[model samples]
Target: MRRTTTGPRDLPPLGVQQAFRLPETADVVLPEGLRVVCLRSPSAPMIELVLRIPFLCATENDGATAEVLATTLLRGALGRGEEDVDTELARAGCSLGAVRRSDRIEISGSGPSAALETLVGVLADVLTGASHAGTEVDRARRRLAERLPLLRARPSTLAAEALRVHCRGDSPALRLIPAEAAVASVTADGVRALHRAAVVPAGAQLVLVGDLDPERTVALLAARLREWRSRRPVGTVVPRAPEHWQRPVRLVDRPGSVQSLIRLVSPAPARTDPRFAALSLANVVFGGSFSSRLLSNVRERGGYAYWAGSRFDDILEAMVIAVNADTATDTTVSAVAEIRAELRSMATKPVTDDELRVAGNYLLGASALAMSSQVGLATAVSTTIGFGLPPQWLESFSDEVRSVTGRQVRELAEEMFASATFTGVVLGDARLLAGPLGEHLDMVLA
Candidate 1:
């Protein structure tokens, strides 16, 4: 666990006078090179461990590695069979989790103090033994075969994939990895090779929080990982994908659909940009929530769709604004027009002080609202470390957000949204969308 000495750089502005403030945690360094920021609180009977590895899609230039590595981790490991891991975990009533984000793979879950050993052992095996058995590969293939066709039926899911394809450019984010083609193409040796280099003990972190004795937790992790070993992650830069990954419009052509699927996207500000705070708040006013401009214009006022919202894909390198909805095919063009108008209004106009406060409060409030659990806090810390934001970033985030003025929000908005690199994807009857939508957008009619 890391020592909790606050550096001068770690001071946060005395922002919110409300909320249960998170404690200052120590940055824990392990025997190999694993780094973890741990916060130990013996306030409960269970301990939550969130392990964050720095190697991610950004590092490899291909986003699929993290997903592939995570999925392949269950076959066997460190002399313990897959059944042994499940039996041990069931005996202890413990849970394991794995998430792949832009910059890291976050492993998190919890169990009682008495169950910690079993949890540790299971993780050790998972990190060391993941075999790509032919049977397991076939099982994964069968699962994907069942799930892939279903994904094509959902608009929201398709739009998200489209956003990834647009933002990341021809990567597996849109296609899903290891592609059915790639997965079918996966060999035992290939999986073994990928695991040997990427799944090193040193390449992973084990974070212990809540009711954990720092000393004991450290000891357990050390013993469990003693033989896990470490290997330096391979580092090589991948050329940047093009800004416009696919064409502007990709009509998936789902005929006779009750609602037309609308996907509107364009790259936006990154999380680390100086104007990030403003962009964030600006986004709130744009489409971060139900109170956003898009919702107000496209839904409430224009009555375009059943639902609508925009999300920021901010992480290691890039970020984007994505909007989706299910509406009538005839309203598709009008909804897209309203969305652009809202984007332009945000960019060209200034927000009100009242608007700024509302956005700030919502953003900050939302953070504390969701993190009311130990698991949530663990996820927050993992992302914070993965993003490499300043130590006081969260502590000071409220103030930065509140301090943002209307002018700043408008300025940031204009800078980020000027190009209008809009992508309009309608995943319904392609014949219905034959009109002016493409003239204003980089349109690809499927």
Candidate 2:
């Protein structure tokens, strides 16, 4: 049998035909001050719920306490056993979990649209009536303790933590990983106290997305969550991470390691800043995507690392631009040099029209894809809400990305990627990296 090869197939035109639009959104503020941002997606059969509680810990110990509380929030609630809670959620075609961040405690859940009420009721029960059983707390503490060593062993993790500590200084956000001693010391009573103090209606934002009427859904949630109230006024704001101008390069020694993890941290504009769109486009061209300069230079062209990328994190008033790469220990210096060169180029040179167009389309495409599902819609809505953006902000994103000119990108790049902007860390075998890295950086051994 002979197979005949045809001529190359024509590819379809890239980019959306029209501007993407967000689902209809409704905002409601309950009497208890729990704000609800609802997105009605009739096409989806599932409901997605994202509840964000402003959860800044007062002390480093409180960080571990809050994490344990979040992990065990749904272990048992309203006199029900852990198994019973799981059974109820399974019956409703729902699953729920909570994560504790430096700035917020996010409780995320999803289920069939018809069982939205059941999910909300379960969440409310967990919020208001969590048992915080001694055994459960001990188990969670042990689990967290057991995970610490594994996390510490990863070079990438070490580099990221160091970068956070360097950029955030003494801010509570610097406590990304709880201390094992602190986790061990967290008692059930402590967890309960932290939960009661931090998880309050006034400090919470509930974002729901699904096939339901926004007003009716908000009313239902209001009634369901009414039982979970707080007496104390809620204003637990995380302090802004202090700015660091010193460009110190710290080396976290991992004995006999074959690869090095490089992480760079710099200040960035917040999401609400008018230059955010331009900066975002600049990042995309720099390293935000697979077709970015960092990947091309460090991985594809230079073969200095297996992967490379950069990300911008917008945490309320705080913002950070982080670049990450992993490379062979022998090529660590080369990879770092390439990364530094790329950062300098971003500041000194204007991006081409093609770069701007590709970045704009990529951003718009990503935004459209993010809003295509119930969960994604909920996440997007919650993120924008966290950024203090209005519901209509989503509708304007495509236009904003499209309107970003190359000049704007260049200006933002110059502002964001100046020589003094970056402070970084490299984690690897110091014996292999220290001499070479010290030649190019002000090295500090950790």
lDDT of 1 by residue, 345-438 (tens): 8766677777877787788888876565677777676666656564356666656776777888888777665535666467766666756666
Cα lDDT, all candidates: 0.66, 0.83
Error of 1 at 220 (Å): 3.8
Q: For residues 19-114, could you state the per-residue lDDT of candidate 2 as single tens digits?
A: 767777779888877899888898769888999987765666878888899989999988998999999999999999998876789999899998
Off by over 4 Å in 1: 1-20, 53-72, 99-106, 131-134, 172-174, 201-206, 232-258, 314-316, 419-426, 439-442
For each candidate, give its TM-score against the true structure.
0.82, 0.93
Q: Kindly report which residue stretches of model 2 are placed more than 4 angstroms away from their true locations once superposed.
A: 1-7, 15-17, 233-240, 314-317
lDDT of 1: 0.66
